[model samples]
Target: MFKLFKHLAFCAAFLVAVSASAHSFKIGELEVIHPHARPTTPGIQNGVAWFGVKNAGASDDRVIGVESPIADHAEIHDMTMDNDVMRMFKVDGVPVPAGETVTLGQGNKLHVMLMGLKQPLKEGDAFDMTVHFEKAGSVPVQVWVEQPSAASGAMQHQEDQHDHSAH
Candidate 1:
């Protein structure tokens, strides 16, 4: 009976650790949810990171920057269509409205561009990253690398198609 109880205790602790590692994190009133990147092909120098930023505070906040050792530079990028051409431009900050969630990745509208990648992001890998906010200061986060076909930005594609049909 004693040995069986010990085994169950160990199992419970292991499960807790695994679940905690996969959970979201918060800094003050800012919540960072499921921060992840997609696996990159060999020799690709650029990658993208996506996550949901929820602001529970009564005031607004801005995400000013992101830093990661795996990349030489990281910046916020915005994509738009101009005269039948799609273009991407760097933005200084992303605004998070009060009591709302700002999704950083949705059909290329907004994303964290990781330029000059030191190495290819592999599936099931994770790296340390820091998100700088105007009001919340800096918060450390883990950016997980997921499968290429994951449901990260794919949902946005379907939404885009639906939107186009309305026009």
Candidate 2:
């Protein structure tokens, strides 16, 4: 009775929240899904954003650039460990093969560096970013600020496991 009604209400609210947080944008044959970044401290000047690009077409594409108003500049970067120290370097692009999905986060080793952030990225906040593709052109997306999920615990360590084209 009352308990059942309360449970149903909770479920409804949960569904709404999930749908609101799940975002995607499409440009040509590429679909940019759930672009997100971890919340950062007030004094942190740099942050990273991650997303997956799904290429449904019969050709390959590369993410050549990124632009965000919240940062002075953004570039594709790769994070890896060299010896016992971590190293990050700028990359020319991240390739998205034909009929494949390329993820830039969740331990896949590539992320976009939002350099010189204008403000701290707080949880539950979102900002606009444009992803430039060599073939598909630029697609505008909203990057959500959120905490890392338990499944993405590897992100907390800053360790990554993929290789990319270095510039």
Candidate 3:
């Protein structure tokens, strides 16, 4: 019967729609287009992953959690400055609002701390990480390991030189 065929087609279409949304984790007003990540060290169990998140939407969103297979733990961390001393702390989340971009960069050092890595992360290698947003759910970020050299990290505050200079 025509009605029976129409019912079947409708059910099929509905199932497809649900699956499309279920497959991806989303971010605020952004698509997380081709997300990439890289670790900090080579031949070491400890590592970090950086991502370039661009806001494609009109409103902002924040990152709250990170999940990955490389490590038993993935912590959301931030660097804090106290007078002449600098320290790192684990934060619950990070905000990347709409119409703006947030880069997980070196030194100012917001990182995805990969603890208990099965193996060392090397440059030119990429791995999978799922970043969770307050509203965007969990989006997968592909991370690659690239060491930050002295030329880059040394010129910056470096976290090694606590000169107490107020520039």
Candidate 4:
């Protein structure tokens, strides 16, 4: 039954993304590859967040920004490597091609970041988040809070260096 529902949801999402209005695309769910939690260290209202999104539609979509009650601002962030130093900065927009899935994983590659969060987030908690696509309209996505675990065997590894061991 669970698998059935999962397939159904995916199918529905695919349908929505395909039937979007002109000049606009649609998304269904945005999933955090491996959600983790931590208490704010200091001088930070909330910690940054990351996740992946899949769009199975006929048109291109661009993830712009997001809005949530938990954060004062949400935006797309891209990671850069500078002479062995890693850096993170906001991207003007994230493009999602038709029938393709965009991954927002760790190593500060491409993901959503909730800046100026109103509250702290932890594992086992669920929060409502919205993803705004340039051509696609915003979609209400649920972010499931998770914990830091060595389960994936690549939690500490950089996003680009992760081997396809999970497969």
Candidate 5:
């Protein structure tokens, strides 16, 4: 009886953890998954947010805008290497192809620039933001502040150790 109870407890805890990390928001035919950002240090006025947009509809959509209470303003920006120099520029919108997923985050060259941050973003903290889609309308998302490697599972084996030391 004690072993059964222990097993059930473990399963319950596992389910909760999985559900908490699998958060996503849907608007129209678009699904926004796991909006997240990295922790910002003090005196930093700028930060970036990243997420993946999956379009399930037949037509393509575009991410036009982003609004967050944690920042003075936000804009969609893309990075490119030009003449051996890295350049970041503001874009009107990011195209999300039909039946495809576009990821905006580290190494993806696209991200949401949160300008004039109201406060420093700390690990384990969460903030609310609205992602505007051209065809899907606006979708509200909760962005989690986590380490890049941990959130993307680039260091999955060290995730537990990282979380323990980070938090």
Candidate 6:
């Protein structure tokens, strides 16, 4: 039937689009998966990129740095609480244990800090970045910028608390 053929064509196109947007890269034995960022408001100088790094090798490695053309500098940062106050600081490196996965994102964990933004990151935008590892060297990745509503569940939950409509 014509309807059935049309439906199959639509599904095929959708699947290809999804797979194309899902970007990943590997450096030696390190696998970086689904690097993404949230859209930032105008004039916001900083944005964060989240991703997972899996080390499949027997030897441990470290994430030493990150570089992006969209910002002046990109660094590895960690959020911590001290005396009920939250603080963020640059970390020397993020350890990737042998055969283990390390996640970088918001909420008291390691994430890539993009400082001195050249421009606000908008939804549906894609950018290139390179992550440097201690043993694996540098691996280039494509980062997708998603709207706030499309952010990860953890980020969406944080945004929900700040929603003013409930007041």
Task: Give the Å error, residue 33, model 5.
Answer: 0.6
lDDT of 5 by residue, 1-167 (tens): 99999999999998897677767899988999889887889997777778889999999999999999999999887665556555567899988999999888534667777888999999999999999998888999999997665445542222222211111
Per-residue CA lDDT of candidate 3, range 99-135, in tens? 8877665335676666678777767677888888887
* lDDT on C-alpha atoms for all candidate structures: 0.79, 0.85, 0.63, 0.57, 0.80, 0.79
lDDT for predicted candidate 6 compared with the true structure = 0.79
Worst ten in a row by lDDT for model 4: 21-30
- State which candidate, 2 or 4, has the greater lDDT: 2
Looking at model 1, residue 22 earns an lDDT score of 59
Q: Is candidate 1 or candidate 3 better by TM-score?
A: 1
What is the Å distance of residue 18 in model 5 from its true position? Answer: 7.6
TM-score per candidate, chains pooled:
0.75, 0.82, 0.64, 0.62, 0.75, 0.75
Compute the lDDT for candidate 1.
0.79
Top lDDT hit: 2
RMSD of 6: 6.3
Model 5: lDDT equals 0.80
What candidate 4 gets wrong by more than 4 Å, as runs, is 1-43, 106-108, 149-167
Per-residue CA lDDT of model 4 for 1-167, tens digit only, reads: 99999999999997786444112223453322322333344455544555555666677777778777777777666666666755566678877677666666533366556667676676667677776767656676666555433532253344334222222
lDDT of 6 by residue, 85-156 (tens): 445677999889999988776344667778888999999999999988999899999999985333357754
Residue-wise C-alpha lDDT for candidate 2, range 19-42, written one tens digit per residue: 887789999899998999889899
lDDT for position 60 in model 1: 98
lDDT of predicted model 2 = 0.85
* Backbone clash pairs in model 6 (N, Cα, C under 3 Å; residues 3+ apart or in different chains), count: 0
